[model samples]
Target: MSPTVHEIRNAIRAATGRFEREFEASFTKEELQAICEALKITVDGAGRPSTTRMRQQIRAQVGIAESLETADDSTFRKAELQAIADGIEASSDQ
Candidate 1:
C-alpha cells in the first residue's frame, strides 16, 4: 500500500529534526531555522506540485554544476572567450 500523506509528513518532520539537531550543535538554532525556512520558501515558490522529476533534474544539474568550477584548470577560459570575441569584432570593423 502507498504511504499516507500523514506518514510522509511525519517522516519529513523526523528527518528535519535530526538535521536541525546536527546543525544546531555546530551553529545557533536561529541560524538553522533560518536556513530551513529559506529552503522551504524556495521549494514552495514553484507553482506546480514538485515530484520525482524535479529531484532528478536537480541531481543532474548538480552533477554538471559541480564540475563547471574546475572543468578547465589550465587557464581562465572566460577571459579567453572574451578576447576571441573582441578579436572578431576588431576584424569585422576593419
Candidate 2:
C-alpha cells in the first residue's frame, strides 16, 4: 500500500526540522537555487524562490523518492514507512 497523508506530513515536518538544524542561520538564495537544481525541481524565473517553497519542494521530492524505493523493496512495508517517518519526526523534535 501507498503511504498515507499523515505519514507524508510527518516526513515533511521531520525534513524541515533537519533543514533548520543544518542551516542554523539561513541558506543563501543561490544555495537554495542550487539545491532546487540538484533535486531536479524547476524554479519559474531568475528571481529567488522563497526558503519556505524550497523546503517544501525538497521534502516532497525526498518523500516521493523514499516511497518509490520502498515500493520496490518487498521487505519494506507500509508500516515500515510509517515507522521511519515517526523516527524522523521524533529525532527532529529533539
- Which numbered prediction scores highest in lDDT against the true structure? 2
Model 1, 1-94: lDDT tens per residue? 5443333323333434433132212223333233233234233344543343333222223332243333332321333322322322311121
Alpha carbon lDDT of each predicted model: 0.31, 0.46
Q: TM-score for all predictions?
A: 0.23, 0.38
Worst 10 residues of 1 by lDDT: 85-94
Model 1 pairs in collision: none
Worst 10 residues of 2 by lDDT: 67-76
lDDT of 2 by residue, 1-94 (tens): 5555444434434453423333223344555455556556787656776665665554455463353233332222445434444534423232
Query: Which runs of model 2 end up more than 4 angstroms from their true locations?
Result: 1-25, 64-94
User: lDDT of candidate 1?
Assistant: 0.31
Q: Which residue pairs does candidate 2 place in steric collision?
A: none
Q: Cα RMSDs of all predictions?
A: 21.4, 11.3
